[model samples]
Target: MTTLDLDFVRSHFSAFNEPSLAGWSFFENAGGSYACNQVIDRLTNYYRKTKLQPFHPFPASEQAGREMDAAINNLAAYLNVDEDEIDLGPSTSQNTYVLAQAFLSIMQAGDEVIVTNQDHEANSGAWRRLTDRGIIVREWRVDPETGYLDIAKLDKLLNDKTRLVTFPHCSNIMAHVNPVAEISAKAHAVGAKVVVDGVSYAGHGFPDVDALGADVYLFSLYKTYGPHQGLMVVRKDTREALGSQGHFFNEGLVHKRLVPAGPDHAQVAASSGVTEYFDAVHAHHFGPQADASKRGPDIHDLFQAHEQVLMAPLLEYIRSRNDVRLLGPENPEERAPTISMITNRDGRSVAEDLSKHGIMAAGGHFYSHRLFQGLNLDPEAGALRVSFVHYTSPADIQKLLKAMDAVL
Candidate 1:
């Protein structure tokens, strides 16, 4: 296993701390991560110095606009795509809602869309809404026992009428990493465009949108150690086909067209901090082997490797406890670091017990209500979620394990 440099990780983020009675363990990285100091500083500085609207003719506004553009460009370059392919929105949920409306204009009433029960409501609900317009919606079911999305099941759902297929790259509740490329190919074979909800997976590491072969991919910046913003990457061809969702004046801008909401300039400027964190990690881990010229996918892979190593022990410890029933795949190879587990006792009760001990784990459906129901776990009786990121420490895992042992 590749080793993560604990000292370097601690140096980068001040949020890494031991469990305290007055504080929380912060195991909810899947929902949102604590913002990095670098991001906070950048945002503060921007607000203090300029406080002007971006893209104006004045020097201050122009410089601010340039900074915002640089941030978007950096993120796009990291994702291995052209700048035009990326659109910045206020939130992932908002982006999905807007994109769904855009699809309505392009797709005919008879067109079919495949949606999975394993996705958060953000991905499933928006597309499913198309049903009201006479669009056919196919359900990509999950295996109740194992919480796995069978590719065979997805195969049966596809046909010539399938115009779009939406699912999570990694489920927020189940944590299973979907076979994106394979699914993308299957959908494309049937003339359907693939849209992936990457909110849970993107924070663990950067994903190459083009390599995933997804026509459109969406994720949240807040969950990835950056600002509160949503990112959507659309293939150039798909963007052209979907048409714009914006006002008549902005119709010419393909990126703005899908996002009817005006861009949040400060939040967009703050997004560059995610790359800043990535750059710092890459330099620390790879040393000279890390090339500044390398794109987002390369740097992200390094962080993924490091995170995988750190998460292995925690997963193993959780598996060892007979009282705990782990959700999703049994092995780390088949899952992300977002581990959701149920105890013999009530999930919330266990979470409360842990809370008394300063463990900041959460217990709920996590908005993947259909997934919990499919797994035969009552959505009302939510499972305890203990998710982590690249910045998570070994000591933090140990603290969680100790809390779990006591609570369970």
Candidate 2:
């Protein structure tokens, strides 16, 4: 099993040394990961040097544009998709909204869309709006007790009318990792497109979008230890069907088609930092054998193995606690490192108590209202979410457990 180098990770993050926040063990990585110092340094240097508008006629602007393009291409390669298939947006929420609008032109009245109650509002609300246009919205509900989506029930929900199916690759609230390959195959068998909300899964490891058979996959860069931006991959064939939401002049620009909003140049430039951090982690653990040049399945597997080892103890501990009700699978194999749980008391109170003890954690619906509702959790009460990334240490988990003992 691969063990995380805590000393090496701590050195990479300056936040660990802050005296006032000495006890603060951040466990809210599912919402947003702490930016790596290497990533921050690159962004700071870029800001100091150029900070000019990209894609212009000037040499400096052209170079800046090339850097941004390289970032997009790198991310696309990681996702196992062509360069033209990728699009960068301000946030996952914005990307979904834009995708919904793009589908509006192609979807006729009475066409159906399949959505899961286990998704974040970003995935649900955008597609749900189709109800206004006489488009049928079918909800695949999760089992209240297990918080698992009933794929067999989904078999009943799909039909010829189904044009698109939206679900989370891994839910933020339930912390359930859906079987994307299985579900995608089912959706494809019926001629429906699969759209996966990958924000939660992406932090644990990069996924192969093509292998998952998702027509479109969306994730937030902020949650993956990079800049606050959204990364979206739409299959080239699907991109051809969706009409441009941008200006009339840019209709042929496939990347800008679904995104009505223009790109954030600096954030786009900074996104390469995520790949940089991943490369560093791979090299640290596996030595120079880490091939940063490779993408897709191989790199994703390497990262996933690293994360699984780091998260094992936390999952085992949560399973042993009768006082805690875990939202998803008790088994680590069925989920990501995001541990969502409900205690005997209000989750927010538990979070505050943890904070007082110098543990950085959070409690709330995490914008996954539908999921909380499906699980019969009060949106206001929420659930305590303790998530970890590749850089998270075993010591951090122990610190969180120690805090939990005092709070619970």
Candidate number achieving the greatest TM-score relative to the actual structure: 1
lDDT of all the models against the reference?
Answer: 0.84, 0.83
Per-residue lDDT of 1-408 in model 1, one digit per residue for the tens?
336676876666656543442356678788898787778877887898767888889998998888788888878877878889999999999999999988887798899999999999999999999999989998999998888899999988899999999999999988889999999999999999999999999997778887899999999999988999999998899888886788989889765797787888888888888788777776666654333336465566666776677678878887788878888877777788898888776667777888888788788888989998888788888898888887776677878888877777
Error of 2 at 371 (Å): 2.1
Q: Where does model 1 exceed 4 Å of error?
A: 17-23, 288-295
| Residue-wise C-alpha lDDT for candidate 2, range 2-83, written one tens digit per residue | 5556677667766677687675778888889888776687678668765898889998788788878988887776676788
| Model 1 steric clash pairs | 245-257
